[model samples]
Target chain A: MLRLSNLHKRFGQVVALGGLSLHIPAGCIFGLLGPNGAGKTTTISIAVGLLAPDSGEVDLGHGGTPERAEVRRRIGVAPQAIALYDDLTARENLDFFARLYGLSGPQRRERADALLARVGLSDRADHRVKGFSGGMKRRLNLAAALLHDPPIVLLDEPTAGVDPQSRNAILEMARSLRDEGRTVVYTTHYMEEAQRLCDRVAIIDRGRVLAEGTVEQLVGTLGGSSVVTIQTDEGDTRIETADPVGELGRRLAAPGVRGVRVERPDLEAVFLHLTGRSLRD
Target chain B: MNAVLAIAIKDIRLLLRDRMGFFFSFFFPLLIAVFFGVVFRGGGGGGGAGSGIPVAVVDLDNTAESAAFAAKLIAASELEVTTGLSPTEAEEAVRIGRLRGSIVLLPGFGEARRRPFWGEPMSIELAVDPSRAALASMLEGVVTRHAFEGLSEMFADPAKMRGQVRESMDQMRRDGSLPRAMRPAFEMFFNALDSMLQTVQEDSAGEPGEAADPAQAAARAGGWQPVRVSTRAVSARPSGLPTNSFALTFPQGVIWGMMGCALGFAITLVMERTRGTLLRLRIAPLSRMQILAGKAVGCFMVTASVAATLMVIARVVFQVQPTSVIMLAAAIACSSACFVGIMMLLAAVSRTEAAGNGLGWGVLLLMAMIGGGMVPLEFMPGFIRTLSVVSPIRWSLLALEGGVFRGFSMAQMAAPCGVLLGIGGMSFAVGARLFRPD
Candidate 1:
């Protein structure tokens, strides 16, 4: 579990994060959904001690003083960019990080081999990362972050440029990490991923968290309504109601109702309804 | 510590895999050494025969004496003489550096020599370049010796000698005092001289068919003829290690090669910073000092390896005989440390890979040029040689040369090694302060 309070960061005249705060519960996939330049990466960077907040403290759910070394040992960071040596093989990269994490000799080798197999990269473990595809590199990057098996994992857009298969695999990996009772902080622009994988989600924009709740609860805040449309001989009629099926039955009783459709408010519509802007913006 | 070793090991592995880096660090300098070694092999003045001092001769007399003198010059093996030039032409050649100096025999040289101890003294003119004044003086001595030998033979007749002795005795008696103890010595000398004159007259009477004058007999034998003069260097090299050019150049080549390592590593640090690897390491559990220390260790290993390889190649291919292996190793270690510190300073000063590379090569090449990496310090001007003391490369090369051939004592070796270590320590301290973690 990680807790960030009153985090303030600035780059020259631009305010990257201004009085931002959030609490991520343990053993859950917590999604920080935001548009580009939404302070998600900045917040994560502060939590990982890569960038220090101007006036804030990061508590790592520990009673003792939270030193940078102890916090780093307990957390793993998969940065936004593919931060790896292209000249080294995947196995060698893993082995190097493992050593940095204080793993030695036999333990380092076993962990690297197991991670290669877990990431489905056993066949290409010996090949340099320079020759790997975008999808394979993303997978290996994820495996490298989890190489030390830290209890807290921070993934900042791990599937930004990945293909659908790699994207699905990464989403599945995040779910599995949550199921294994580890704290997962996933930052992304994809609203559907938050809907499917995250147990709790926070929508952030311009260095502030706009809303935070469960999927149903956040959608309930959007008035708990469904959109119903009826196509008739004259034209199409649109209707907003709390119960789409009951409204459809009532609309069928009227004349010249050829077809009926019902749509529940998804997280995207909820986000648009709540913030008066599209999530992608 | 393990993390530091891991980083150093990884850096070395990556450097080795870079083929272009390897070539510049090792083979390129080796090729330079070989090319220069072959080109300058015979040019060294190793005090050997046939390495003649270049000069010209102008014979204006056109007489048998002058012709015989020219012939004598041609016969002397040491002199590489260019003949058949006029005085004006020889002087022009000397002025233009085509010759080191020139010898000119005046037109009346033969006639002047015939009258022994009189008539306008015939002088041979020596025209030389001012830069070669020392060489010109040596050549003058050789020509004077030839002239004296001819004079001694030309005045060999007993009658002429007796006349000159009596004339000298009469002058001394009139102008100065003969010691009281030496009056009998002069009387005995006059009696012995008359007896020698009678013996010479009897010998001439016995050999009536021969020339009456002993000088005429000597002239007939060609011994009293004008002595033909020529000049040549007895030995080319006056001092230092035997004239092998390779022995002189390999040390400089090794320095250049080691400098290549510094340039390569400096550029590597910049690349690591720009590529985000440095940020990743900073975020890791390792401390900042550990990362820098690892990189420094890697640079030292590579530089020392390059220096050792060059030495081995010099010994095998160029036949450079090293004087002390232990001293040479120490020199290499100290030089590597100096360059590694230089690499750190380069990295700290430049903000990007391109700037780092440009600054690294610019500074290194400047140091190399001033420090005698491309040309030996012996060929440089006084001020440039004096300014070379500021260059770390100069100290490194001097230390290496001392270890290889100068046969430096332990105390002598300490001076250069201490300076090198001092440079490394100072550069590292300043560079560390300037290093940016970003």
Candidate 2:
């Protein structure tokens, strides 16, 4: 579990994080969704002790606020960029990070090999990362983050430039981490990824969380609107209503109406309704 | 500790994998050293030991005194003298670069010695190639030295010197303006000179010949003879190994090699930061200071290794003598440490790899030029030589030369080594303060 309270960070004239707070429970896949420059990375950077907030407190399952080393030992962070030595082999990169976490000898080698295999890179384990594809490097980056097997995992847009297959694999990996009772904090611009993998999601904008809940609950709070369209003899008739079932039945009763269709709002519409802008805007 | 070693090992491995790094840090410097060493072998004053300057001698006097002086000039270790050449022939040899210079002894050289105090102004003409001025000056020095020695020997005979003294005193006494009080002192002086002349006459009584003139008498006694002016040109021949050229250039090559290491590793550090590896390390359990220390250690190790490799190559290819292995090692360590600190400072100064590389090489080349990388310090202008003390390369070269061929004792080595270490410490402190992992 991790808690960020009253985090206020500034970069000269810009406010990166303005009194943002979040509580992530254990064994949950928590998604922090925001557009570009939405304080997601700033928050994750503060959480991992990479950046100290101007004013904030970070608790990583400790009674009191922990030091940077303590927090680093408990959290595994997969940065947005492929932070690896291009000259080193995939296995070597893993082994290096494992050693940095105090793994040694046979145990270090074993962990590195296992992680390489887990990421489906066993065949290319000995090859330098410089020759790896974007997706393969992304997978190895994820594997490196988990080399220490920390209880709290932080992934910041891990699949930003990855292919669909690698993206799916990363999403599945996050799911598996939650299944193993490990707390997962993921940030991404893809709404579908959050819809599929996150048990609890937070939509942030301008350094503040606009909404936080499960998909259904957040969509429910958007008035649960549904769009109805009827194919009439004259033309197509459309209506937006909350009671889609009753409204569809009534619309079907109209004369010369060939068919009626109803569509419920999804997470995209809920996010737009709360932020008053598109996710990418 | 393990983490620190791991980081250092990783960095070294990366450097090894980089071909450009390998070339610049090791192969390139070796190539330069070997090339220059071969090209400038025994060429100038900086040329190595045992190689003398090539010169020609034209002895027109052809007297016994002239021949003896020529023999003495020929026996000098610094001059490779050629004899039995006419003046025109010796001048032609100098003109065609066959010799560094030529010396021509005039016909009256031996006659002038017979009356040195009132003789025709004897001139020992030196004709030298314009391009070999330093060698010409040195040749002039050799001729001048022989002339002075001949004069001293001619004046050494007590009989001839006493005769000159008595003649001068008699002239002074004949002048009535001579003070009455100075007469007693002059008398005492004449008495001492007469006594010395009597002793020489008694000693030379066994000789059969007698001459009224003091010059002839001294010449007959074989005590004082006519002065001889010897003229000889000197040139150099290539003697393999331990030449001054190699001695001066080898340390310069080592400094360039170290500079290459510094520039290469400094750019690598910038690359790591820009590529996010530095941030990743920061996110790891290692402290910020540990990460920097690891990188510094890695640079130091690589630099020292490059220096040692260059030194060994110099020893093998250029026949550079290793004066003291321990002192050499200490010099290498101190030099490497200084460059490692410079590398850190360079990394701290530039934000991008391109900028860092450009700035690093700019600083290094400037330092090299100022510190006698292209020219020996002894040949540099006075102001430039004075400014060379500010260049860290100068100190490194001093320490290395001291250890290699300068035969510096432990006490003599302390100043250079201390300056090198001081530079390293100061640069490291400033660079560490300015460095930012992000």
Candidate 1 lDDT by residue in tens digits, B1-438: 888888878888878878898888888888887787787676541112222445577888877876776677666544557887877777655543345567888777776666644344445777764323345566676566666654564243655666766776676566546776776688678668756654554554565567666544434433233443334322112233343567557777788888888888888888878886776677678777888888899899999998898889888877777666777888899999999899889989988988987898899999988987876654455467668888998889878866776555566678888999999988887887899866
Error of 2 at A107 (Å): 1.8
Q: Write the per-residue lDDT of candidate 2 for residues B136-209, one digit (tens) a residue.
A: 56667777777666366434366666777788888988979989999989989888877866676665555555
Residue B254, model 2: lDDT of: 86
lDDT (Cα atoms) of all candidates against the true structure:
0.76, 0.79
When summed lDDT is taken over every stretch of 10 residues in candidate 1 chain B, the lowest stretch is: B232-241
Q: Which stretches of candidate 1 lie over 4 Å from their true place?
A: A63-67, A222-225, A245-258, A270-276, B44-243
State each candidate's clash count: 3, 12
RMSD of 1: 14.1
- RMSD, one per candidate, in order: 14.1, 13.2
